[model samples]
Target: MNHALAQAVRLAPVVEKVHGAHHPELTRVRELTQALADTTDDARIDGYYAELRAVTDNYTVPEDACEGFTSHYRALQESEQFWQNR
Candidate 1:
């Protein structure tokens, strides 16, 4: 498992325990992210990133990471959008 993927795995339980896993989109995202964290290659991460991107198309994650993976990914998404649209 990749180090970043390990972080992603840690993030998932935090997500579930604190935020519940009722939303399908987030459920899919978390599952994929868990898989993402379990992977051990570039191609695998890339593939999972695509799956995650698809699941996240219109979704905005809750801002309750208190400085963790969710916050980081959310910030990364917003930064990319800013750059992409700038």
Candidate 2:
């Protein structure tokens, strides 16, 4: 968990760069990432990650977004073992 966490963290630095309402969300991400890195409970980590991803990816898929979520979700699952296991 610790090994790959840094890369996952580096993906969302924009939230922290700006000081505004978004700060709280990034702060929570930091807190949750820490908890996730420290946690060993499968259910806890899985539940937290699932909730986090759902909230972070709140954008709706436009009809003409060029692709369906199934493909995206499949790719995500294939590359991320944690997601695949789910």
Candidate 3:
């Protein structure tokens, strides 16, 4: 529900479109993000964070990442901080 999480929620579709349906990671990320957005319980958000971290591997960004990729990675990191600090 924080700004960074909200931003990542908004950015998911663009990432999915760029990665296409063939990219399983994006699909999983989109699903987990949507789940996070749908819930109000903090416990649920924490659970989602665990799954998201597994998917993102702590939001690690590749050196060769394009702008979109890097933005998406940074967004995840920011969102994670928002969630954890809550």
Best by lDDT: 3
Off by over 4 Å in 2: 9-23, 58-86
Candidate 2: tens digits of C-alpha lDDT, residues 1-86: 44345444443343334422533555555455556666778788777667556644632332432233323323233324554454
On TM-score, the leading prediction is: 3
**Per-residue lDDT of 1-86 in model 1, one digit per residue for the tens?**
43444555666566655555454465666687666555657677567676667766633565443455365356435433443354
Model 3, span 7-71: residue lDDT tens: 78888888878764555587888888889888988888888889888887877765655677678
Q: Quote model 1's TM-score.
A: 0.54
> Which whole-number lDDT from 0 to 100 does residue 6 have in model 2?
44
- Estimate the TM-score of every prediction: 0.54, 0.49, 0.83
Better candidate number, 2 or 3, judged by lDDT: 3
Q: Could you tell me which 10 consecutive residues in candidate 3 have the lowest summed lDDT?
A: 60-69
Task: Decide which is better by TM-score, 1 or 3.
Answer: 3
Clashing pairs in model 3, backbone N/Cα/C closer than 3 A: none
**How far out, in Å, is residue 57 in model 1?**
1.9
What are the lDDT scores of the predictions, listed in order? 0.56, 0.47, 0.78
Model 3 C-alpha lDDT versus the unseen true structure:
0.78
